[model samples]
Target: MARPRTQLLSRDIILDAALELINTQHDFTILGIGRHLGVNPSSLYHHLSGGRDEIINALRERFYKNIDLASLQPGHSPWQSRIESWVRSYREAVAQYPAAIPILIGRIVDDVPTLAIYETLAAILVEAGVPGSQHVGIIAMLDALVFGSAIDAGSPEPLWNTTEDRQPHLHQAVASSSTPDRVASGLAMGIEASVAYIERLAVGPSDGAN
Candidate 1:
């Protein structure tokens, strides 16, 4: 008697499928995933733990999997360049999955690569003479800039439409700066401004005791 072949499933399959769901459905349930993969929802539990939160962590890991810290390390580039490069890389990764940005932000980052990013950024900041006392606030500001920029990258073209009759100055400004990728330009400016602020902070004192 010939035996029936069983289906094989892996973490990669779940991750890919989940990402697809996030891209399309934007609201997928466990049963939905099971239907999509033709597997029992319980089977998914065998590989993924913590339910939706775990999936979110996996998604973030996939997004940030390729973040290289070498270029952003202290010796490789100036501190300002490092910050700008890191922000650029983060925005690039985050821009891919706009729908799940909230999930990523809501979950605590426990992924190894993500942790390494924080570690490297801290080390670089320390090298730049940023004291430990200010690290949290500065990092928060940087994160806001990066994540906000990521979200802004997907903004609709000509995002604002102000009528000249209603608001002439606003309309004129919008027209003067109108372009296909103004969001991208804004992101660049935000990163540069954050870096400039860091430079100013580096001037005052060596609180890092370096």
Candidate 2:
């Protein structure tokens, strides 16, 4: 009889291990991931042929997979509403793994699901009368807002320590802010500003205005 096989190690397991490393350590190597999983680094290659880069792409997919894309479907809803929904969902998904932000940003996005989300956004931008030339720039700006907000979401509460004596204006602003959820409030404001900017682009510059 053949010897019994060892415990199974699969792609999900490897990816989870890698994500754990990224979350705690802010980065991971193939060796580190394998060590976490109590397996040899070479064994990860069996599941991920492309190695570290592949793992990074996989993690990107994992992060974006949580976004609910149904509201984003082209429909009767105004483009602004769709964009807001997407931003909220994207932030919610990413904020859960804020530590992964640095690692994810370091890699160019090549994940298919993630790209599909961008493609959807691009289509919406096209429908909104945004010029094709500006699509990438708008998307980049939105990414900055969303990712920055996500990172901020993970920051310690009372993000700034201000005192009336040292910084009266800042302390007053922080204390007087009406919104309980600063991150959400700020993200909503940013989204509205971005949408307004996009609308202006759609309308195009006036003849007399400089």
If scored against the real structure, what TM-score would every candidate get? Answer: 0.87, 0.90
Q: Which prediction has the highest lDDT against the true structure? A: 2
- For candidate 1, write residues 12-74 as lDDT tens digits: 888888878877887567788888998899898888977776777787788988788777864
lDDT tens readout by residue for model 2, 1-210 = 976586568989998888788778988999898788887899899989999989888877877887777767766477877888878888887888899888888988788978888888897887787898899999999999989999999888889999899999999999999998998889989999998888888754322121
lDDT for 64 (candidate 2): 80
lDDT of each: 0.78, 0.84
Q: By TM-score, who's the top model here?
A: 2
Worst 10 residues of 1 by lDDT: 201-210
Flag regions of model 1 displaced more than 4 Å.
1-8, 178-180, 203-210
